[model samples]
Target: MKRNDCILAAAIFLFAGLLSVMFFLSGNEQGNYVTVTVDKKVYGTYPLDETQDIEILTEFGHNNLHVENGTVCMTEADCPDGYCKRQGEISTEKETIVCLPHKLVVEIQGAKPNGGRTEEQTDGQTGEDYDILVK
Candidate 1:
């Protein structure tokens, strides 16, 4: 290999390493609350700092969510597969525990100043409000 090739390769690797570090640091802000959704509708949003048990009883099934010490997990569930219970704890933004059979989704979210969710967050939309159509 030539000298210039080695320098270019090292520079590219350094840039990639810096970008990765920045993304890791910026994306790891701890989530403040979790939003529970049932059948595509907002069930509720619970704070992570508080210790509480949330019993979600929907027509499809039941799930018991336990929140404590800034983390939340599914303690119990009546779903046939019980996959939600095995998803472990989620305390970072955008992490989720999903129960497919019950159509339930629990996702971590960063809080607003007023301790309430934005329209888009509560409405189950993560990004901008614009819609795109392609035919």
Candidate 2:
């Protein structure tokens, strides 16, 4: 290969590496809050920093969510499959625990520093900012 060709390849590789690093750092940010949704409706949003147990009882079923040490997990559930409990803890943004039978979803999210819901969230809309939507 010519010297110029090698230099161009090296620069491209370096730029790619830097771009990957930037995306990794930004995308994997730790989540400060957990949002619970049932049947596509907002149930509640809770802070991960606080140690608490959230008991959810719906006509479909019941679930126990335990939050501690900045991580949230499904500790108990009445679902037949028990898959949600097996999903384990989540502390990073976009991670989720879903109980298919109960139609319950617990997702990690990054919230404003003041610990208040954004205007969109308060207006009965989700606060998530989607980068892409697929059919």
lDDT for model 1: 0.79
Q: What is the lDDT, from 0 to 100, of the residue 1 in candidate 2?
A: 67
Would you list the clashing residue pairs of candidate 1?
Answer: none
Winning model by lDDT: 1
Write down the TM-score of every candidate.
0.64, 0.62
Quote the lDDT for 30 in model 2. Answer: 39
lDDT of each: 0.79, 0.78
lDDT of 2: 0.78
Q: Tell me the spans in candidate 2 whose CA falls farther than 4 Å from its real position.
A: 1-31, 112-135
Error of 2 at 7 (Å): 60
lDDT for each residue of candidate 2 in 1-135, tens digit (9 for 90 to 100) = 699999999999999999999998865663488888886666788988899999999988999999999899999999999998999999887788878788777877786323344533533433232212111
Best by TM-score: 1
RMSD of candidate 1 to the truth, in angstroms, is: 12.3
